[model samples]
Target: MNSFEKDWRFTRNSGKGFESAELDDSSWEKIDIPHDWAIAGPFSPDHDSEVIVDDPIEHTRKVFSHPGCTGGLPHVGKGFYRKHFELNLKPEQSARVEFDGIMSHAEVYCNGRYVGGRPYGYSSFALDLTPFVKNGTNLLAVSAENPPGASRWYPGAGIYRHARLIVAGRIHIAYCGIRVRTEGNRVTVRTEIENPSARKVVLTTRLIDPDGNEIASCQTSGDRLFHCEFIPDEVRRWQPGNPVLYKIVSILGDERHETGFGFRDLTFDSRKGFFINGIPMKFQGVCLHHDLGLAGAAVDRDITRHRLNQLASIGCNAIRTAHNPPDPELLDLCDELGFLVICEAFDEWKRPKTPRGYNLLFEEWSERDLRDMIRRDANHPSVIMWSIGNEIPEQYYPEGPEMTRRLCGICHEEDPSRPVTAGLNNVDDSITGGLFDAIDVKGFNYKPYIYARYHAAFPDAPIYSSESASTVSSRGEYSDRLFEESGRKDNLQVDSFDLCCADSATIPDHEFKGQDDNPFVMGEFVWTGFDYLGEPTPYHREWVRSSFFGIFDLCGIPKDRAWLYRSRWSKQPTLHLMPHWNWQGFEGKEIPVQCYSSFKTVELFVNGISMGSRTRNPKKLLGAYRHVWSRVPYSPGELKAVALDEKGKALAETSVFTAGAPEQLQIDCERCGNMVFAVVSVTDRNGNLCPHASERIDIESNGKILAVDAGDPGSAKPFPLPYVNAFHGKCAAWIRNPGKTLILAKAVLNGKTVQTEITAEA
Candidate 1:
């Protein structure tokens, strides 16, 4: 298997005879397969900007609101990729080329002959190369074209994912054709063997547990379709927190194939929400996009693992791939790490979200794309739901019901184990018109207000907030003013302590209590858990690089809201205080304080003076539910909160104090093999994090520096730099190296320079 990530000849300009094997291509530059040519260009402002008038409601290019600002980078036009290879093929072997993903319009050619084409960029496709191969030297050329305005966000130009050549016997186990299902103590294994050779063969199968022990075996005759069942003495079920997987290996004469499956029993009801293996659980989930900062559209396993682990650390139990299918590796990691997954298929259906979006090609590609996504991801135990579409405007059209039924039917035909769902913004149309009846569960995008009303009307349907709480805030920056299309520039700054959007002031808290009051509501997947590239709505300044809707910033660093979610979702005794007590103007003045804790009551202290204890209100008002310590006199000293359980015994205590000038540097590193991420933080003399610090820090490491991510969406700097300006006194550098490695980071502020070193394990 090959990713073809490096050593490729690329050109942005179109040329005649470029796909020919004899063409001279030395003028073209060398690049990697998972490369995004546009992000490498200088940032642009006027590219995706719209004109503002008296009212922000009448803004142009309203469709751009979907994916956040595209980081003001070029995502359109055409680029060509060519890979030259020489492989001696066996007479009985057949070859094929597989593209995991590509950007927009892609056309493939082998040895100057057209092979196939893909109109939808997100879909994974492959073409037979047996008819076009010459056995010795082969020139595989591909041209990817994504016109401007073709995408709703920074779709990343070029062959932005893995591509590989596969050589196998003509009669072998098919790709992604193995399906496994478990019930009681018996495991059902089904295999689809490709027998184009008109030859019959005997196939053998075995089940291997996580301990690498073979527990069961079976034999069957292969005639394109084969099935077998193995009954073990015991079964270890797969759950959200404990994902136990077993491997199924299929053997046919000399051909062999293996895949992993989990033994799980799932059921859902309006009252119970979701249950895996008979245990009720809430999906403390987040919606994640496909792009990784600096890495662009390429799916790096290490980088992807880091991002998911970051969410897991903050108590994220599930993931919803916002609008499209994610890299296959993501599901593999999810299965191992015990994360529930909702693998989505598309962002739009028959109707176009953008003037030139996927709908233009939906007529021909939707079914195949949907089939590929489902087939590729069906075996993973982490996948609990197959989301058909996200906020599809087609749901309101005349043929809505029929279209919904067709999509859901396709999913059922492909994988019957998982239920189908869609993120519907038009709740009234979906439920009243019978479109909702086609899906097993209903998912509302931003309609938490109508959840109770919907439940009252139709109490039997399992429902969840497929996407919710689009709280917009910048890391560290604070502002009391609100923003508009023609609003003041100062309104763009977001206050860390007051992280709430105009749509909903008390986010998560408001939605949290709704789920508690309505047991029928499964749970919600927030609009985002991490800030991502593009869709820079509320903060669309020229230099802005990312959307600020995540609980964590772009660099995977947690924001102030992260603590609140942790306090609400985490099982451990959680207590966190916000707003550093270094305010200059509010000296000795009473400042409204808030604390997030799972405990029943919290006691507050100001400079060693008891500020009294407070408990959550019995009434479910937005302001009343969130733990608030009204009017605590502030001083340039310490402020602490001690959490107490229902009985009044102390559970946990945390403190925040007036910090001194930044005088020290701290770097914490998490290493896995050659990939390492060093979190660089600027702190005060007492080792307290200076939350408001934005000092530019230079980074140097004894390793191949892949990227530096700071999680600052409003910063002007691109994410691929060796140095980064700390956002909320924090930033991180991603490095790739083997053996013992060291990283040094330094920052200068107020005539003082501080440096820190971090060493990664070999």
Candidate 2:
């Protein structure tokens, strides 16, 4: 296998003969694979698309109040890419090219000849290039386009995932053809082959444990598909927090295929959540979108790992790839990191949600896409369930149940080991309409109040909150007055202290109580684990673009809500205070103090004086997990919280200090291939980031400055620039390394400059 990721020329143009093998593409932008051109956006709402205006009365699924729901990025257009390579192969050997993912309708060509195409943007596909291959130099071309208003959130344009070239003999194994299933003590391995000469193939399978010891071996001979079984003496089960893995090395002819797998006995009970390896456990999951903040839809390994690690730190063990399928690397990471996964397929079915949504392509593409997703991910032990569709409007239609049945049947046909589920918004209508009985597990989306009602009515149906806790907040944002809490007057900063959620969704407290009260119900996957681009609720104006639903901000910074979750979900003791004690204008005013702690009681102190000690009242809303001193007077110095056990002994403590004026610039950086991001924020004298600092930061870099983003979704000040005023005291610059040398980036604020340098290896 050869990576087709590097040395590609790209252009945002459309015309015939561009795919010609002899065409000169020297003027096109030099780039690499796993690229998203849309993230370097103008973010102009003025782009040629029908904009949706804010509607005050109605709040629906994927339908935000405003028309700028898609992050107002330039994702609605066509882009072309071309690559050249030399290849020489024997007559018996053929070749194929694989694309991990594309944004939308993609047409691939080799040597100026059209080979294949896939309409679904998220599905991974491979095209046979043997038909168009030459003995020497060959040219490959691909065109990708994002239709106007194709998605509700940011679905980036171009090839946003890695592409590869695979060459194999005529008797080689089929693509994603190896399947592993564990039953009792026996394990079965099925292999599909592509033999043109009708050769009787000998398949040798070896099972290796995590410690790399070959424990068992099996052999089979067949002209068609081969099946091998092995019953190891000791079985290692894979579970969250303890992912015991094993590998299968299969040999057929000269082809050697290795796969990683784990043996697990998983069963779901109506009265007792899910039992894995005979141990019952609740799923503390979170719904994650494909975008990687400033990286857009491009798959970055480090950024993706960082985001997942943040969720894992707060005790999130399961993941739901919201609305669509995910990159294959994500599943590989989940397997290594011990995260239970729900590999979702579609966001819509036959019902249309947008102008050119997946509804139009459902008939021709849904089945094939669903099959490919299962085939590619079925081997991963982390995958416990397959989600068919999410919040689809078909739930309200008369024929919804039949479609659900059809999809469920396809899932069982493809892989029967794991159960299939769908995120249902209308639980009542789904149950009464027979939609509930069509699938294996019912995923309740944002209706915490009906947890008891639905369970009581359908006693045997296993249920879990597919999406909940959409509470919105901006990190480091707070105000004593309710009027200033709105984002407009505060640099688009929503109040962290005054938490609000959507009409369909509830806060963390509501979902917390629901999950805590109903032991039978499987735990909830929060609406989002991180704040994402677009779908800004409550403040869905044209200027505002990114949602505030995440426990962590867009840059992966933890918000105050992260503390609340850590207090509830984590086993390690946690004590976190909220809302920085920096009220200048509202001195002596009543400031509500809040803290989330694992201990039984917590004492609040202000300016070295004890306010009071408080304990949670389970019967009261938000009082079950949070300690509050709502009437504490604000006097800027320090506010602290000391967690005490039932014996009144202080076990843990945390403090929040009032920040001074911005005095310096602090910078952190991370590299993604040739691109490096400089995250810059202004800090006070005590080295704390001043939340209100909107200082204009000018950056001079030895390398080329590609783009600047302050995690502000509304700011449309052209991303391909070098200077920007900080938003929430923070902004980042994307710098491209020109050569293998030290690249210094200097940030100047108030005529004071601070610099950081990195050496790019050759």
Candidate 3:
């Protein structure tokens, strides 16, 4: 496999006949793979096209010119990309190009001849280039179109994932043709082959242990199917707490395929929630969109690894790729980093949600896409379940049950080892229409309100909160009003108090109780783990271009609510306070404060004076483990919280002080391979970050600038530019390494320049 990523000429919006190898593409913009043409937006309402979205505030479903649902970017159009490569293949060799993902309808051309095309962009596919290619030089062209109103959220444009070229002999293993399954101490290996000459190809399989030692070996010869079984001396079972993986290498003649899998057993039980390798535990999961903040829907392994690490740090053990099939690299990272995953297939089946949604081609492509998803990802140990659809309106359609049963049957047919589920928002309708009967596991979307009632009604059904808590908040912004039903209409920010939840959704604290109240219920996956590019609830205006449903903001910075989950899910000692100490106008007034702690008792101090000590009250709605001091006097000094164990020994302590006026800029650099993420924060004379600051910052780097963003979704700021405004006190600049030992990033604010140097690690 060879990377087909770099040196691609791209033209956006308007183009024709560019797929021809004879056409001149010198004027086209040069770019690399895993690129999103829509990310660098000159955001404006003028780019708006009407798309129907769920609006609970209007009391009924309505449609209007709400471009915020798609991030108000000019993304609905054609994106053509062409690349030239030298591949001198022998007569006995065959070639194909595999795409991890494409945004929408993607058409591929090899040397000006149409090869293959796929309608659904989320599903991965490969196009055979053997028939249309020449001997020496070849041109590979792709035309991907993101149709207007095709998606509910910002479905990024163009080839936004890794691409690879595969060349194999005529008698080679098919793409993703290796299937590995484990039952107890036994491992089953199934390899599919393509033998044109009806020859019995020699197939060899070797199982490698985690420490790079060959533990088992088998030899077989077959024309189509090669099956082998091996019971190793000992098995290292995979668990979310400690993911240990083994590798398998299969060879057919000169062609070889390598894949990593783990040995583990997981099941969903109606009586005792979920179990991993015989031990019962909750699935602390989050629903995540495919977009990676600055990277848009384009996936980067390094950047995604950092995001997954952050989620794992806050005790998130599982993930549900919300509403669509995720980038393949995300699953790879989840497997390596130990996170359970629910590989979702589609947001809509046959009924159209948006004007040009997947339903437009669901009739022709639904089964193929579903089968490809299952076949491509069946071997991953992290993917314990397959989610067929998410909140599909088909639950109410007359033919919904038939389609549901068909999809479930397809899943079982492709991979019988895993369970099938769907995000059923209309739970009653689904149950009544036989859609619920087809699903092996019940997935409730924003329906924790019915967990206890449903468990009583169907005691034998295994149910989990597939999509829960839709809490909305903006980092660093505070509000006196706890619950803003419609959110704040006056500003581009939401209150960090985490009370501004959507009407269709409840706060995180409420869902926390929902899971606790019913021990038989499986865990909940929050509506989102991080802020996304679109589907901005409550804010239909063009200025609000992203959703505030995440525990972390768009820049991957954790909000105060992260502690709320850590306090409950994590066994590690955790204590955190919210609402910064620098409320300029609320001086000497009563300010409500809240602290999330795992300790038995917490003592709050204001200006070095003890306010009081409080213990965990299990019956309280939000105060069970979250300690709250509603009437603490605010002053221009310091506030502290000390968590104490049952015996009154202090386990952890944290404090927030009143910061001085903004004075300087601070730069912190985090490097992942050749990519450097330079974070610029506004600080006062005492080096305390100003949570409310939005200072204009000009940044420069010795490396190439990939993206300059302060997580401002509404801004039309050009990403390649060096100028940005710190959003919620800080901004982030992503740079590509220019083959330097040390990379320098400098930021200027208020005539003072602060720079940080990063060494390229590995």
Return the top candidate by TM-score.
3
| Ten contiguous residues minimizing lDDT sum, candidate 1 | 479-488
Best by lDDT: 3
Count of clashing pairs, candidate 3: 0
Q: For candidate 3, list the clashing residue pairs, or say none.
A: none
lDDT of 3 at 159: 90
List clashing residue pairs in candidate 2. 52-67, 534-546
lDDT tens digits, residue span 1-762, model 2: 135688899998747887897789999999988889788877765443344543542443344335457777888889999999889988989898989898889999999999988888999998878889989999999999888867888888889988988888867788888999987667899999888888687889898989999989988888779888889888878889898888999897777988998888889898889988898888888999998776578887656776787788898899999989889889888988889999999999989888798999998888899999999999999999999999989889889999999999899999999999999999878888899899899999988888899888888999999998777777767666433122343466567763567656777888888988898988889879988877776565555657887888776767888888887888978898877777787888898778888887899999889999988889888567788777789998889899888888988888888888777777776565565656787877788777777777766666777566676555666666677777778877666673553445455545676655555553
TM-scores for all predictions: 0.94, 0.93, 0.96
Error of 1 at 732 (Å): 1.7
After superposing candidate 1 on the true structure, give the runs of residues whose Cα lies further than 4 Å from its correct spot.
Answer: 1-4, 48-68, 479-491, 502-506, 540-543, 620-625, 645-649
In candidate 1 the C-alpha lDDT for residue 99 amounts to 82
Candidate 3 per-residue lDDT, tens place, 1-762, comes to: 135798899998337787887898898999888889888877766564554445556766777567688777778888899999989899999898999888879999999899988878898998778888888889999999888878888888889888998889978888878999998889999999877788787899999998999888999988999999999978888989889999999988787788899999987899789999998989899999988876677788878888898899889999999888788888888889999999999998778888888888899988999999999998889999999999999999779999988999999999998999999989999889989888999999888778998999899999999999888887777765465475654676778777778777888877878888888888989989999988887676445778888888887878888988887788888888878888888877888888888887999999889999888877987677588888888887889999887887888899988888777777777777667777777888888888777777776666777777787655667666776878868887777773653545455555666655555553
| Candidate RMSDs in order | 2.9, 3.1, 2.0
Global local distance difference test of model 1: 0.78
Count of backbone clashes, every candidate in sequence: 10, 2, 0
Q: Which stretches of candidate 3 lie over 4 Å from their true place?
A: 1-3, 51-55, 60-63, 647-649, 738-762
